[model samples]
Target chain A: MSTPYVRRFDSFDRVLHGFLMLSFLGLAATGLPLIFSDQPWARRMTGILGSFEVAGWLHRVCATMLITVFAVHLSRLGRRLIFQRDFGLLWGPRSMVPQPRDLTDAVGHVKWFLGLGARPRFDRYTYWEKFDYWAVFWGMGIIGASGLLLWFPVFFANVVPGWFFNIALLVHGEEALLAVGFIFTMHFFNGHLRPEKFPMDRVIFTGRVSLEELEEERPSEYARLKASGGLAALQVPPPERWLVRLGTVIGTTAVSIGLLLVGFILYAVLT
Target chain B: MRIKHWLAFFSVLFVATLTFVAAKGPTNIPMKAPPAPSRPAVVKAPPEPANDDCLACHGDPDAKSDTGRRIGVDPAKFTESVHGALDLKCVDCHADLKKTTDFPHPSKLAKVNCAGCHQEKVAEYDRSIHAAARRQSAGSVAATCVDCHGTHDIRQKTDPKSLTYPLNLPATCGRCHGDPDVIKQGHIQIGNVSDLYKDSIHGKAVSKSGLMVAANCTSCHGSHDIRKKSDPDSRVFRRNIPNVCGSCHEGIKAQYDNGVHGIANGRGNDKAPVCADCHTAHQIQRADVASWRLDTIRECGTCHADKITTYRDTFHGQVTSLGFVRVAACSDCHGAHDIHGKADPRSTVAPGNIVSTCRKCHPTAGENFAKYDPHADKHDKARNPVLFYAAGFMKWLLLGVFGVFGLHAVLWLPRGFRERRGQAKHS
Candidate 1:
């Protein structure tokens, strides 16, 4: 038996998420040309970007959108924590601590991979996922704060020593290198490289889960929902099941087409 | 029926509210006109008094100064002055009329700046190092015109009493410039040039003990047209140094350019010596027996110490210090302005041409002596390869030995907390 999978994100949250993703991607695309300016490819990239002034305006607009989305997300989180009484999910005392058993499990997993032991039991969220999420949060905070400092440099010039600007430049560049490296190497490997999840992960969009998936992947959360008397909602009636299935098919098809269009446009422009 | 009635009534109310809001929006209020400014009132005042009566007493020719010097009011001579030429009255320069009891005397006066009149001469003077110091020490009794020329009876060279007259120039100019007390007080560094020039090769050819016809104050400073060295139009500019000196030392300048020192200076090397550095201005003498017995290299070595030390360490200096006439001082390999570097295609000491520049004196000179940089000291091992090899090898061997020892420290040193944690668990 599985627990009911409530829609996790509101409409506002989904819209904000989309805006953030678009702007972040736009900034990265526009900024890379300026970074590798000495290369011949940079010239071609700049040309495709249509004049630096227009590109600059587009980048700033995107940045503003990203910041607005971040503010909205923060407000939602604040409301959830204060008014909605959902602080238990976040700011709850964490139990995902490094323990003797966790160490043993980690060692066993490594051993299993080496053909020296059986695979260890795992829980709902892996240590690596927690690390990646926290890293992104820290990266966003640092990059955002440094960017604000750089944006209004004259305000700080009177209070801060000149050397701080040099330090800010160094930190901005190195932090960017770390973020890009992690995104391409570790995040891509973890998020998109698994065989079953290989071409896509649709759960973020649908905000749903199957009984078998809940049992296999999130047994602890499933058990909690069952204890909380939410399991009845998990069993969909025959008529509602068809409706949900139809919704999923249309939604997935629309999303897939949109993603392909974006990819094709990008390919045409970049080349 | 009630729902339909309420919806129709509310729709009519909404339309009425929308119409009201539209009526209140965007009225183009006319701009208010700005107030006109009032004109300023003019204030009238009294007229200036006349000074025609004052000129009566000042126009007298028999008037004498309190110190008994004749204060002859020479209108003609005064008119020739720049202030007079500019139509400036004597009263413009003088003030303090209340205390005066004399006629043809300045009622009051301020010290005159001749520069206010003679602007071009002042500009030329200002750019020279002498005028550069004037701002700092303006009140110092330094080289003013009256110090060389008499104040009341100043004249051109044609006048017998004129300080610039050919026979009298050196003695007249030297009187203040050569006085040990005056020179010391003024901190003038061109040491006793008036005395020394009186005895130079050119000096001996002239008639008097203290005067030279070929060279005098005006010979270098120019009669009345003396210009500053900073001006490119001036004869004494650095770029024109070789040619200026060559006017008298033609044979020497030709030979000197082939020498290394002249070659460097011609290429704009500030470290290279100018003609004045060794022989010196004001104290110049012939490089004959009286001076040759003394080490010429010692004089040149004041600035070229490393070269001096390097040359001393060589066989050339060993013979030269002992008074060998053929030994080099600085007039070897680097000709004057005609000099080009070894890198230049036309260079006399270029690898292809070095044999010839050396062959002028050393017919059998090998390439070894020609390749050596004469300015370099033997102890400067970085430039001297044999010493560099010996020192560098020993230093690096020691560093390599120490580096091997340091690796032991690095490899086992905690190896960061992550590796330490793993190691502890394994143990």
Candidate 2:
């Protein structure tokens, strides 16, 4: 029999993910060259954006898109928690929260990686996924804030020290490098590129997963939802083949570009 | 008395005609002496060609100008001259000697005619400012051939003893130029040109090298045809500077000719710089040297006033202003020889080319690195808001990131360690 499917992310989240992917990649492509401008490759690559001024224009445009998606995502979460009173998403066993079991699970996962223990059974989200989720908030907060300061120092100079510009330059460059590094390497591998998920896990892009994937990977969330008689309510038809195909195409393109960016950053670091 | 006047006139005219027609300095002739005078020895008359006769009176140590200044001619010094080499006799240069035999050689003796045999050189000298001043009645203060090269004591330029020799040019030109009395006459200021040259890179090289090859008074300024700088034909004229400097620096000349200054000058802007405007004429300093490096920035500031101010405010500019050589300066990014305008695609400071230009100092530089404008004037908000605010925002972001994250990591590490131990014990 064909496996049943469960809706993990909604259509709104998937659409937001698509925009975030494009904007992040755009920012990276147009932005990294400036950071590595001394590189022959970077100098040549920046020409693809027409000129430095055009590149800057595109960068700011993409930055605006990214911040918009982030803000909307947060607002959606706020509306759910404050108005709908969906404490289950925040505090229940299926919630994306740092519980005592999460600490044990993290330790257990490290032990498993080292061949010292059985693997930890995840819920709806693993400790590493939560870390990845929160990392965006952190990266965006740091990178975005500093970027705005460098972007419009005169307006803010009335409230802050002039020397802050130097500090901003340092932090913006270094923190962006760190964020790019984490997203391109640790986040990509854990979320999609791991052997179990290879060539991808399009749950975020397609908003669905098969019954077996949910049962095996998030057994606790599956069992708890079933016991509460809410599991059937979450079940849905498998995503359309065209939607899956589109996700594959878009996701693959994003991953390929991300890998290339990581390679450039690595080269920049070594040489 | 009439017969005596007739004899003097005929003899002087005969000598004058012979002198003008001679193609070269007159050849020495063994003169036939007049019949020996049995009269007192003091009354004995000398023979023709008259070298010894004139030398006997005028070459004496006590021979004096009208002001009683000694004007003695040492025979030894004269024999080394080109005129002396050809064995020219005294009457060759003094054609009117017959008229000067009466007692004190009339107040004004015939002037020494260097132009007779040196007609080509005199023609060149006539075109020079020195000659122009004399012609325009700037005074008899202007230089003449004899002023630079001694009258009877002149020698071949190759001989170290010659006044016109390359190594001796500064002193030769300096004699009248630096002479307070001559300067007071107001033809040319000279402005301690000799002293300035002596302190210059060219001067030090010439002095230390002890060679005629190093640049000296005659190198930039033509020897026989030196003119005022305002003359278009002058070697030091604004339009001619690149060519003058290019004589020795061919590569730089080719580069500079395509540069903005060279282009400006080509378009007839007199205010545009040539080599001297920055390097200075008599006091050129080597830019690679210490003090000269600092002065080079200041020299460029002479033309680009506000640029220097902006450049100095940048990190590179600030360090350079503090005399740091490791940092970049005006010529570093703009280029020393090939400097172009910002609109030019080849300009090092242009949007497309700045990355590579800055790469000289910052090897890791990317297009973003070039975005850090070296000429960014902070006061210009509209132009620099992006860079300006980016810097300000980064400061607080860093503080917030470290503050929240530092606390989170502090809380997470201990809890995770405690749980790991508890899980191990429970198992």
* lDDT (Cα, tens digit) per residue for candidate 2, span A190-232: 6776555667888887899998878878888888888989889
Instruction: Give one digit per residue, the lDDT tens place, for model 1 in B232-327.
Output: 655666655666677767887886676566778779786776676656555566665535424456766777677776665443453344334454
The candidate scoring highest on TM-score is 2
Cα lDDT listed for each candidate: 0.52, 0.72
Pick the DockQ winner: 2
Look at candidate 1 and tell me the lDDT of residue B221.
57
lDDT of 2 at A207: 92
Q: lDDT by residue for model 2 over B1-427, one digit each (tens)?
A: 5575456445545554554455276544322211111111234344333455566666776688778977677776777787676445565566566434554455565876666666677889999988888898844788888888878887878778898887887789889776777777754555667778888888877777777777777778887788888899998777887888888888888888899988888788978778887788888888887566767788788788988876665545544443445567678888877789999998988888877886786565555445555666545667666555654565565466556444544444454455557556876
List candidate 1 stretches off by more than 4 Å.
Answer: A1-13, A91-112, A115-124, A232-271, B1-427
lDDT of 1: 0.52
The alpha-carbon lDDT assigned to residue B134 of candidate 1 equals 54
